[model samples]
Target: MGVEVLTVSSKGQIVLPVKMRRTIGITDGDKLAAFASDDGVIMLKVVKVPTVQDFKVRLDEAKDWAESVGYKEEDISDIIKSVRLAKRENSN
Candidate 1:
């Protein structure tokens, strides 16, 4: 768990710190959910964590995990790379 302090702008917008946004992969045009806790604390959560250009990273991570769990490296790498390249093309 981590916390970041951000000053709300005059336009009533608070930019989540870059570190937080990048960590959560939230991007422009994405919707967030805001709620109030029982203790009167305002909470903001990403309603949908966007998959922007992050599929590559996820694929690499998954490959490592799967290999550790006894997956065949050749097959996993081929599939992951294909999907990653497709995502890159689609993002353009």
Candidate 2:
């Protein structure tokens, strides 16, 4: 909760304070996302990477929605091709 100092090892690893870890519910082996802000501040957040099954379920739902909207498989394929071509032209 208060200001705490930590030392980085030669391997560039720092142990978070026990109190801070406990308060934030951070456990050992948890994944953390680290990014630098525009102001040069580095921040870390606990994040989860979705599994393959998760993506499969999402794709199924999207397909169901598209079918409900009366879009056929060929229609979807053509739309995808058109969008890809447009994106390529814009990049050029």
- Per lDDT, the best of the predicted structures is 2
Quote the lDDT for 32 in model 1.
Answer: 71
lDDT of 2 by residue, 2-71 (tens): 4344688999898888888898788988876554334222334456665556545656786799899998
Model 1 agreement with the true structure over 1-92: per-residue lDDT tens digits? 35454677999787788788788777887677553334223343555563534444655786689889887856755766677787777679
Task: Score each candidate by Cα lDDT.
Answer: 0.63, 0.66
Extract clashing residue pairs from model 2: none
Find the number of clashing residue pairs for candidate 1.
0
Whole-model alpha-carbon lDDT for candidate 2: 0.66
Per-structure clash totals for the candidates? 0, 0
